[model samples]
Target: WLIKNYDYDLIKFLQWTCATPMKLIGKQLTIIDEQDMICLENDYSQCQPSQNSSIIK
Candidate 1:
């Protein structure tokens, strides 16, 4: 909405957002708080599960 609702002066806003952390899809998220710092964190399960071939035996 920022791009559409705002005028041509939003260039800075766009730049700042690029620096901030971003929330990823599927149990992962990275975001920056009001303090303007980068924060990265995600659920342990978000990582791709490893296959256990031994269990198939």
Candidate 2:
């Protein structure tokens, strides 16, 4: 939804996802964008939980 709604690049998104800090709450994942203007939230009910929780940008 972030990529589609914000027109974010795939490579950049992947890199950002790799480097940026994130927060997880149960099945929800939250991360700030590079511009620091948006917060992306993803549901990971079908996947494993993430390990890192650093703030982005």
Candidate 3:
């Protein structure tokens, strides 16, 4: 709820919380684009909006 309501950068949050710790142990981290990000629930929900796609905000 905080994430959706706050002016926070999701990508930065992932990098700091997930990627940074893994990199310290020599793990390769790939940065994904915003367009590739999707919020799913039970592998069926899509939360990102696209112009050419059918996903609605």
Candidate 4:
């Protein structure tokens, strides 16, 4: 619907959908609150391995 109505690129839209943390109820996607978004960002940032880490390299 969004693609047809707004002429959005399918790949970009899917990429955005995957990158943003949101609730998927059926076919509808709901936005996460600011607090949840901040928490998710912090969680991912803390878990990232350093570039110099042997495990990643």
Measured by TM-score, the strongest candidate is 2
Candidate 4 versus the native: TM-score? 0.22
Greater lDDT among 1 and 3 belongs to 3
Model 1 C-alpha lDDT per residue in residues 1-57, reported as the tens digit of each score: 655777534544453434423333232123423343323455333333333323544
**Candidate 3, 1-57: lDDT as tens digits:** 656776456554553342233213333334543433343343233222223445458
Would you give me the overall lDDT of model 3? 0.39
Query: Candidate 1 at 29: error in angstroms?
Result: 23
Q: Number of clashes in every candidate structure?
A: 1, 3, 0, 0
Output the TM-score of candidate 3. Answer: 0.22
- Name the 10 consecutive residues with the lowest summed lDDT in model 4: 24-33
Please list the residue runs of candidate 1 whose C-alpha ends up more than 4 Å from where it truly belongs after superposition: 1-8, 20-57
User: Per-residue lDDT of 1-57 in model 2, one digit per residue for the tens?
Assistant: 656666555545564455333332232223444454233454233233345765699
Error (Å) of candidate 4 at residue 38 is 22
Local accuracy of candidate 4 as per-residue lDDT tens digits, 1-57: 554666334534443344443332233323433333333544544343333435444
Candidate 1 has an lDDT of 0.38
**True-structure RMSD, every candidate:** 13.3, 10.9, 13.2, 9.5
Q: How accurate is candidate 4 locally (lDDT)?
A: 0.40
Query: Which ten contiguous residues of candidate 1 have the minimum total lDDT?
Result: 20-29
Predicted candidate 4: what Cα RMSD to the true structure?
9.5
Model 2 spans with C-alpha error above 4 angstroms: 1-8, 21-57
